[model samples]
Target chain A: MRILGIDPGLTRCGVGVVDAEGRAVRLVAVDVLRSAADEPLEQRLHRIASGVEAAIVEHRPDAVALERVFAQHNVRSVMGVAQISGLVLRAAAANGIAVELHTPSEVKAAVTGYGQADKRQVGAMVQRILALESVPKPADAADALAIAICHAWSARSAAPTAALTPAQRAWQAAERASRR
Target chain B: MRILGIDPGLTRCGVGVVDAEGRAVRLVAVDVLRSAADEPLEQRLHRIASGVEAAIVEHRPDAVALERVFAQHNVRSVMGVAQISGLVLRAAAANGIAVELHTPSEVKAAVTGYGQADKRQVGAMVQRILALESVPKPADAADALAIAICHAWSARSAAPTAALTPAQRAWQAAERASRR
Candidate 1:
């Protein structure tokens, strides 16, 4: 099954996708959702949402994986991140894509066998696991890929009979209609 | 002097501009930057940047005001807000506009005479201050106008000299050349 992973941010979001069968997974695409510094937050979120939807449309992934927001020291900052995540989740939900959220530690542990791996270490682990020639540039991009990889592994081991919820199914139908 | 205020967010960003003369401020424009829920963040940021630049070009504001990001409880969320703020700052710096930042509490206090005013109260304050018949739609949009109003009150009172800083002078010359 194909899976899309996202690392959502206000200024830039990283997206990656892969297909998995058993222990094997193949990279499909990876990209960064970027926003201009001067634009309003709502505009930026919309841009991010659009980019993610376009990617989903292009890839037609079976599932979407996103990193969960963790507690931080700043309230305003957390609010913004939550907002970005909200948009990401909304986009996936609108498309009827099943979503799985992994904490940073879970993603790190899944991808690197450690929960607190530094960015560079994670990058190396991702490259090694994905069998890529070089590390993904812009750390966020690599993190996005890692998130995708984590999902692929988790889904492969999970039950397959679990189907999309009715609401999700309806959304998928609506999304399909819109695409047409 | 003209001051532009921006309330940045992921879904909808409100932008407002006003002319400041000592304590008096006159509204110039107030609008929202909107993006679809499915669009990517990068494309959205680009659009936002373009929109802000277009507004700046049209209004030729003397200064720009932005809301300072307050601490949030989520690390990822804070990062996203910071990213948005970074883009906003970058856009202002690129245009050689004098940039000022105000806290949410500060803006609220200036506009509503209370630091903890609710959205509706703030909207009412904006309408009253700007002599509008109705409240600004979309809370974010009204917040943006409030930010501008705050700048007009505080930043304008402690006015910077008319002479441009060295960096601003260089940027202005470059901008002029580009225009020609």
Candidate 2:
């Protein structure tokens, strides 16, 4: 399964795509879409929307995972996050993609095995899990990859073992062997 | 000038259009676009976006006036408003129509000469100002009309007095005379 994860913001939106088979996952793409802070709100929204649309078209992920916004966060930035998330949700829907929202703690726990993990811990776990040469840059990109990993892991667990395809079963066995 | 005002919400979005020549204002259209609460978020957003887009195309308003959302408002409902407002802002930008956001107090003050006017007072003032036979139904619809009126009055005031067209001046004089 392929998933696109988004860390939505008005000034900078993080997008990451990952492909997973059984317990193994690999990064397909990761980048941040940036817009100038000084730009008009409409133009900023349009820029972010277009970027997200382009990513969806380019990656063709089966599902999208977005970080849920909490109003209790920095009041100003939270609004921007919510607004950008709206556009992202709309774009995903237009393309017939299923979307799931994950809270920050959920993502942290999924990626680092600890809900209280800080950015550094999450980044370290993401790099180790994906076996990347280095952690993704600018924090946002790494956070997006973590979100994808979260969805990918949860999605795998959600599937019934009996429903696993032959290839998935084989991959799972190989993963188990490697862990030994 | 014709202005389209939107009270953005996920379940029911209020839209109102009005034409204004100086201080004389008349309602052009008013409506409440609704979506089922049980509908998915993306579908709800799409429904509202389509409705606003269609309104813009049909009315060809010179500007859009949207109620500004406050984070301090109902926490759950505020997110919906912000999300819907994002979509509305993008639609207006795509259509090349300028959008201005007015606070609730501003709308009340513009319509009823009191910033703290209640809904009933605002609706009554809307009916009186527009010379309508009855107040527009649904508080959302009336609120929308009040927002448009707010924008119309502010836009007129923002324009330098010397820039007023002959027709606008004549309408202003006639409105003043009729008031006498």
- DockQ numbers for every candidate? 0.09, 0.54
Compared with the true structure, all predictions reach lDDT values of: 0.75, 0.86
The digit string of per-residue lDDT tens for model 1 on A1-180 reads: 678999877777899988765457777888988988697554665677678879988998777888987655345445556556655665565566667789999999988899999999999988998888899988889999999889878754323313567676577558745753
List runs of model 2 lying over 4 Å from the truth.
A156-162, A166-180, B155-162, B167-180
Candidate 1 TM-score, true structure as reference = 0.52
**What TM-score does each of the candidates earn?**
0.52, 0.88
Best by TM-score: 2
Q: Name the lDDT value of residue A179 in candidate 1.
A: 56
